[model samples]
Target: MKRICILLILLFIAFNNSFGQQVLKKGFLVACGDDKLFIIDPNKSNNNHTEIIWKWVVSEAKSLPAEYIPLLKSLDECKPVMGNKKILVNSSSGATILVDIASKDVEFYAKTPMSHSVDLLPKNRIVVANSTHPKGNSIELYDLNKNEKVLFTDSLYSGHGVVWNPKDNLLYVLGYQLLKTYSLINWDTENPSLKLESSWRISDKSGHDLFRIDADNFLISTHNSVFLFNTSIKSFTDFTLLKGKKDVKSVNYYPKNNSLIYTIAEESWWTENIYMVNPNKTIKLPNLKLYKVRKAI
Candidate 1:
């Protein structure tokens, strides 16, 4: 029994070491403003851990293709899209692009002025939100396989955040002060369409990101606070995560560690910050305007 236990311990240590080495190699992608994209390697510590083992810029001058110039000029949200296959990037210059992970290629691109958020779907479909400035208050579905054509559009007030929940098989869109749920009927066919399932007021001003907690509930970041939204009953329970004039940018849930990671930026875009809410911790990052946080898969 003692020898068996010793072998198991050794195996576990080997597995952990292998995983850590893999992280040190590729790290995680972080999209900072002004054409900066970094691969950060996070290391664990016994106390307050802010030490990044190693990191390098991936979206450098040479890596960006000519077509991606506009996107690099003013990148907003940079996180791995659905399935962790490509990075979904939204830009202030009105571009939505999907970058291939291995090839470093901008596989898909679209011009969506004032585009705030995006959600990837099956069959090369993407749902995007336009919040303010040029052509605001709209949610659109673009078919990438079909020359980036608009397949659907719904009028919502200052549409900002969009997410596709596989649990309820619905698309949740957040606007200035509302949450709209839609049932994607006949989505697999050529005649795909969205039916309005429900709509409700979520906040007084504007709402930001939507992080799925589970099939029954999710979390929402807004101008005032973070809110827990239940899908079962279609209700909201508030959590005071934001305060004192700080605007929330994104909230992401980490399933492996069972934690929540969120970002907040000043109204004037002076600071980009990250906080671990579950453990009540903060991760140090370079001075750059960031958008979203996603766990590296």
Candidate 2:
């Protein structure tokens, strides 16, 4: 009994320490730019460019699978996510890898076939939006519970977004072309049916990402703007974001801190910087050269 108690205490301490290493507190902002990914703590009082905590160079310049080259070059399409003291990065390599922020190490990596998009699901499951030549587009669920995973859905449009609705335990999938729903656990689609609702158009053509905000609204971005959508009304109120830009790649609204981070463009593909907006709805962050990390989380 005494030995068991001692072991339990040690385990608790280790877990706590691991978590402490990840919390950003007040000093840092995680930033990933072209080729390089790092964490910057901007408030040093003495210096404006605070110390870089971690950095990794991600590029197709290195020897990468031919399949992934398309995904990497198409930088605007990659999306990233934070999970388990690590970040999950997925791109054309059709590969998903977990990076340990503390050690700057890749925890584990597995290859899938060109993941079009991935949704972070409960219990570390990655709900992937994918399509094979003949299968077409569908929702594929990767159970992190197991190492290499299996397909959750067999049919879906090739260009759609898979989203998890938290209010109720249901999966909300909106394709660039269609919309559907299923149970997050298993590929249970009884509520929505087999075929996605072709009733609504998710995007015009050059599709963008959808910000899963409050239960009532979802913030979506096209090439040049961000808009808030009220599902009940099936209408959207456009947020006057950085205008007169050639393109707007992606946008994320951080409501907990009352800020929104958006990427703008001077050209068709490259970026200017990430802008933070406030009450007057003005862009705040100092202008800097930043680019998308290129790997979708």
Candidate 3:
């Protein structure tokens, strides 16, 4: 009886240790302009020095039409959704697509000009950030069940990022020198719209990225610097680590340890490496025009 009790205790400890490690492991999804999305495990090393456990090329999406392939070039945003089972990807070239991770299936897609970022909303809806272009410079909403159809539109100059805040039930958009929030109007119906709730002018022009840091805070990056925004008080403070960092394309923060993984546009609007702090490592990938990196939730 004594030996059996000791064995059970040891097994319990081992299980807990393994679970803790899994919870702390950092994995990310990378969007490459060369038309690929990669899921990387930073803790593991392969022949390329970084383990790419999963990857998706445009050609691998069998369900996508051949005519739409060109629109998906220059992949810019890749955000994991639905517990990382699906990824929402968009490109500067002009497309936003939702892909099933395991099946490599194109679930939903739409042509969004100069698409920079995308987010999934409640009630089977999604939003796209359309940057500067003729048909761009607007925040477009769509129904996931109906592909290639725009449900609603609102003008936003140089719109670059869209994030849905579940806590406040608001949609936050980042644009050129502007940050705005909208309350969903008639979201349950087919003819839904967005009613502007509030707006704030950023310290500088050309807002590039907006990502949620926590329930009450969001991380915003612009052409000049990065700021930590508090939703409760509607204030912005410089994120000291990348306080004055210019041309930051994407920034994702893990609040558990206050660690960050981000990318900066080194060659025009893309880079060949992803930067991380709080262990401080740069993972370089050759022959890829990497644009954005998001935590694989």
Best by lDDT: 3
Pairs of residues at least 3 apart in sequence or in different chains that clash in candidate 2:
68-93, 79-296, 79-297, 80-297, 81-297, 137-156, 160-175, 160-176, 161-174, 223-248
* Of 1 and 2, the candidate ranking higher by TM-score: 1
Alpha carbon lDDT of each predicted model: 0.67, 0.50, 0.87
Deviation from native of the Cα of residue 133 in model 3, angstroms: 0.5
- What does candidate 1's lDDT look like per residue over 1-297, in tens digits? 999999999999898655444542433435445455444544342134545543323353343446657555666676665445456777766777776544456666777777778887766688888777657578878886654577888787777788888887898888888888988878888767788999888765778777676777777777777788888888888754444334667776655566666667764642455666556666655566666655555
Q: State, as a TM-score between 0 and 1, how close model 1 is to the true structure.
A: 0.77
lDDT of 3 by residue, 218-290 (tens): 9999999999999999999999889999999999988898788899999998898888887578877778999
lDDT for residue 1 in candidate 2, whole number 0-100: 100
RMSD of each: 8.0, 6.9, 7.4
lDDT tens readout by residue for model 2, 1-297: 999999999999898677546644332445543434555443331223335555554541333444443443221233344543555554433555445555555543445454445566766677665534344455666655454556455566553355666775556565544445565433343222223332455444333455567776676555545566666677657665533333455566656766665666554444545454542222222333343322121
In terms of TM-score, which candidate is stronger, 1 or 3?
3
Sorted by TM-score (best first), the order is: 3, 1, 2
TM-score per candidate, chains pooled: 0.77, 0.65, 0.89
| N/CA/C clash count, model 1 | 0
Regions more than 4 Å wrong, model 3: 1-26, 45-48
Poorest stretch of ten by lDDT in candidate 2: 279-288
For each of the candidates, give the backbone clash count.
0, 10, 0
